[model samples]
Target: MKVVCSYCHRLLRESPGEAVGVSHGMCPECDAYFAKLWGGLKLGEYLDLLPVPVMVVDGGGRVVAASERLADVLHRPRAELRGLRCGEAMACSRSRLPGGCGKAEHCRECTIRRTVDEVHETGRSVAGARAWVKTDAGRVPVTISARPAQGFVEVTLDEPEALAGALGGHAPPSRR
Candidate 1:
């Protein structure tokens, strides 16, 4: 098979094969070029372009990137939200406890943490998992969806009522 650069149409390599065919793939040059181009964009900046409230959580469940929509809902600056655990970012009451964030006992049963962890562990997506995040204001009901993206998980938050209505009045399944 002959491997050719999909972007520049440059011949990359040829391998022994019974079938004569061309495989389209990005060459090192094109890959580096695009990587450099995209590398110019900050994670938060790229995530802010998303329409919905979304956040990128690293393996440690830290908020590595957050969209402007999420920041607005959290009432915090996007830059400040970075490096915070999901619980802290969402203002979960347990996060304020002595151990803080994931260290608290309630962290084990936390839907948001569990959903994100499940997606990371199983490499499967969790959609519309209902969760009640206890904040300083009160217990706020929300629906969370998470998908593994590269080495990070992109978690989206939506209003429970809004998601329920979108799902034909049926609440999404709990992914405990």
Candidate 2:
């Protein structure tokens, strides 16, 4: 069989279809050279090093992928969050207002519901989105950053108070 030579840019013969090497003959020297030139040797290790919680969200803001850190925040196994609506998973259904009106009263009207829409509207990634997440305990403030990743969108959440301090702004004292 004939195979193209990587370095020579020409076709050469292979015995029973042995792949050819750089410009000359198939050899360990050429294979090593090519691998060294273009190969990701440590890609897996790099991904494992990320410390932040990473999440993949659909255009409708449903969680598609989430990291272990998110499990800690939501108090559930990471697998349990898959396919759940973002609003429902965040416990927004149960939040209460000063009048004791629950999330059933107005969660659909919350501003954070517009987050992904805003991203799509501006045609750009968003950073520093302050949103309310209702927990079993109560409503909580969170800061979000979002961008597209691997054909899907990604969002990350951080504590609003910590984010505010990092940005040199003060978090409003809790009213409760």
Pick by TM-score: which candidate is best? 1
TM-score of each: 0.67, 0.53
* Clash number by candidate, in order: 0, 1
Instruction: Write the residue-wise lDDT of candidate 2 on 1-176 in tens digits.
Output: 45555574455655664654433454455667567546654422322233554466676667777765554455556778777656654555443443231235564565555666566455578888887765554566777777766555666665535433433344443322
Sequence-dependent TM-score of model 2: 0.53
lDDT of 1 by residue, 17-134 (tens): 5579988999898897678668797777677656667899997799988987777667678889999999888777789999898789988988998998899898899989998788
Clash pairs, model 2 backbone: 8-23
Candidate 1 residue spans exceeding 4 A from truth = 1-40, 160-176
What's the CA error at residue 73 for candidate 2, in Å? Answer: 1.3
For model 1, what is the C-alpha lDDT against the true structure?
0.80
lDDT of each: 0.80, 0.56
